[model samples]
Target chain A: MYGWIWRRLPGNAWVRAVISLVLILAVVYVLFQYVFPWAEPLLPFGDVTVDGASAGAGAGREEGAAR
Target chain B: MPVRLVIRTFSELCITVGAVIVLFVVYVLYWTGVKAADASDGEIHRLQDQWSRGRIELPAPGATASAAPPDATQEPQKSQAPQATRGAPTAPTTRSAPAASAGTEPARRPARSTAPAARPPAYRDGKPFAVMYVPRFGRAWDWPVLEGTGVNTLKKGLGHYPGTAALGGRGNFAVAGHRRTYGDPFKDVPLLRPGDAVVLTDGASWFTYRVDRRAYRTVPTDIGVIDPVPEKSGFRVPGRYLTLTTCEPEWGSSHRLIVWARLEATRPVTDGKPPALRS
Candidate 1:
């Protein structure tokens, strides 16, 4: 998959490397700013309240309560 | 050539998945803390600015009117006053910030009634109304206490349970914070010792609560720990109390750790920092 992506690039190797770096950073930026925050509430690691169901089983119940 | 391509793609997919997982862990453990710190600091500054401008955000007066008993509803009721001063003249003199001590003192002292004061007006959810400091956490460790315990609220800093007692009021003023990420506001919750002070200010008065005991371990479902008279906390009657809850195991939320405190003293902000904070 990565080889195919590399071969389809429009630039020489150096330019492709720079473009890849920028693309990688943009992906990470999106992950941290949007994806992770949205997904964190779905995970059990951040749970703190006493009213919700325990982590792992029925995790969605806790997420709903938290909302 | 097709088989080679398939193998290469499979290897790249595996490597990409592994890298993403590691990055997610870094986001949870480190980046979140950085973002929370910035958010919490901004909240503290905003609260202080509001206080300096003489704007104290109280819960809507009528919202809790029916719930609060007649005696408890009074704004300056003795029930909500700080119980007593527990310090000697020779204060610890540990680390006092000059910037913090510059405010003018309130002209009148808090009344000494012993009744448990009613809960204060309901603060708006996600709005910061007070600042909390634990000397044990470090002289510089302080966080803005926002008014709800929801996930997004806790990310800003310590969150005050909505139905609990207000700061310096009778009943339990329970707070929850993250033990790992989101600035790890309660990371040292387990280290709190009996008599350690958990000080808080709502712009007008400084409330000093002394740790009643070391951390009490319990499951997250044990909501009784924040009761006005938490059974396991050694409190036999209703009184002013504080409960700090955080996830246990340091890095996971499998269980919970609780630290109970009793109101020790209430000082007007103009009087300077509270005694517990001096050390």
Candidate 2:
């Protein structure tokens, strides 16, 4: 019965739909949930947060010089 | 096949970016570790010993008279300015120490050397430089008495020389330090009046540089401050000069406050050479 239901769904369309859901979930859980809290301890006053690329540049590289 | 290739390329791009991020973090951690290690070496400890106390009986003010850590292995110095944290150069820079915490300090601009006096100051006995005193800032400011160009020894206290003279192989031997911070070794440096003396020792010989003139000047990174004739030559002639530099405007200077002295005379370090420094 389950196989029949899954089989009824369009393969490519369902696959696309599932990927879209996973992407959205990743954004919410990984970025919003985990990242925001991780940064809160470093500089509490500033509300805006830098992404992985920008923070990596600041923490690891020289401030103004190019990579 | 084309779609699969596109996804693979994107994933590869992400991996490359991640690798770069890891490498950068490692670099910062390495330098921070190195700088920390350099600060506590025996040289610095010896310098601190020299600065902490002195035995020479200096003449009272106005008269040509005399003067005067720990490391967590990893953490970069939090309290000091970047220059303050760095060790002395093999040959230090001119010791400009730019005002910005992160921006580079321009090296001291060299003025022409003054003509050598009847008796050019010589390193007597074994002493190279003498301990000059700064009265106001109190205890923290004592420095070593270096013989020729002071840039190398100044690193023991001033951090690194910002430009040329720091190399220690050249014309005028220049020295530098902080004003109010870094123990404010040079905080009262700007207050030095004419006739004040900077004595240098080579252990056996002592040389004195007199506070002949003082001025304020702007310095650019490329400008060499300790050239044979480091200063601008207009009415002045050339010879060996000693310039003391620190921040301007007393408490703080957006620009440099400079005190230029000519080599005057030197005394020999005698059998009873008391500490040449005082707190």
C-alpha TM-score for every candidate? 0.81, 0.37
- Candidate 2: misplaced stretches above 4 Å? A1-67, B1-141, B145-156, B159-170, B219-225, B233-235, B249-253, B271-279
Give per-residue lDDT, candidate 1, residue B79: 20
Q: Write the per-residue lDDT of candidate 2 for residues B1-279, one digit (tens) a residue.
A: 879777777887797567545643443234323432343243434533442233222221111221111121112232133234222111111112123234223222232133222232433211223344443334433454332222223322442222322211224555554443223356566556776666543322234556675554543221234344654422155545666655454443345556666655432222112122332
What DockQ values do the models have? 0.37, 0.03
Candidate 1 chain B has its poorest 10 consecutive residues by lDDT at B86-95
> What interface RMSD does candidate 1 have?
5.7
Quality class of the docking in candidate 2, CAPRI style: incorrect
Residue-pair clash count for candidate 2? 48
Compose the digit string of candidate 1's lDDT tens values, residues B64-125.
21222333212223322221221111111112223223333322233234533655566887
Chain A TM-score of model 2 comes to 0.37
